[model samples]
Target: MPRNPATTTRDALLAAAREEFAEHGIAGARVDRIAARAGVNKERIYGHFGNKEKLFDAVIKDALDEFAAVNTVLEDDPVAYVGEAFDRYREHPDLLRLLMWEALHHRSAALPDQSWRAERCGRKVRSLAARLGEEPSPDVGRAVLSLLGLAMMPLAMPQLAELLGAKMDTPESVAAMREHVMGFARAALEGRASASG
Candidate 1:
């Protein structure tokens, strides 16, 4: 079946809104700007999403869907999945910015998609624990968190990375850092030396 024009409009809105939220954050984002970027009337945003907060949530869901679509070799090698995840974040720094916005806006309140996000993360925690010959206990959970933090820290805190002299000014540096992340994860799991070795 042919794709509906409404779907096209919704996708355009999501793309436009992702950029808007990433740049301006929820408090700063404007509906008219999002609609203008999407090349649709602002009313469509209200019609399709009800409001700006809801639109921002939808953009996050769209990003989650995009990542889920890239579920490569996770079952075969969780370590390789870690490397792929690092690459994904490196390529989509805007997503990280959008997340920072979400964290800032919803610091105390529950996220709009809290339940769904928990369920999604729960699956990964379970998978990682099973791969390590254990249940999803606190230790395994912390390990999974470490893996994600290793991938995200550079993008999420580039100033810190720069201060630590881990700057990725070129492809070679990026590749080296990605390899270090994967190697560090593998080494941690295998009880071996650090990636620096």
Candidate 2:
């Protein structure tokens, strides 16, 4: 079937916007550059997304949706879940950059798709709870959030990871980081479970 031209253009614009936002963030990204990279007229961006901020929101939503789809929490092994999430982030470091940019741009204000993101987080907490054979509680939520933070730390602070003797670009270093993250998460969650029991 022939693809819709509108969809094709939207995809192109999103791809261009992702790169721009990751590199320069919302405040620094230029609409003209996004249009030029997308090979579309600048007006199309406003027409399709209303404005630059909206376009940035769309880009973030797309990136996060892709991440959620690929990195589901495992029911039996949280470590494996963290390992997979770490690998995905290693492959797509831009997602972390984009997230950092969003935090910088939005600050304390309500973020775009905040409710949807919260709902997704809730689902992850439930998944983690099921994995641990426990009810979804604040403890499980914290563990899930902590594990995600651990997975993101290396990419989010490449310089720090490197200064701390982590080779951010090599597979072996990433594997070692993953092992540490899994062990840390396992110990914390196990301790929490034992305390509660």
Q: Pick the candidate with the highest lDDT.
A: 2
**Stretches of candidate 1 exceeding 4 Å from the true structure:** 73-75, 107-109, 192-197
> What TM-score would candidate 2 get against the native?
0.91
Per-structure clash totals for the candidates: 0, 0
In candidate 1, position 15 carries an lDDT of 93
Per-residue lDDT of 5 in model 2: 95
lDDT of 1 at 108: 69
Each candidate's TM vs. the true structure?
0.89, 0.91
Residue-level lDDT of model 1, residues 116-146, one tens digit each, is: 9888878778887777766777776787788
The lowest-lDDT stretch of 10 consecutive residues in candidate 2 is: 69-78
Steric clash pairs (candidate 2): none
Q: State the lDDT of candidate 2 residue by residue for 5-79, as single tens digits.
A: 999999999999999999999999999999999999999999899999999999999999878866445566777
- Give the poorly placed runs of model 2, Cα more than 4 Å off: 71-74, 107-109
What is the C-alpha local distance difference test score of each model? 0.83, 0.86
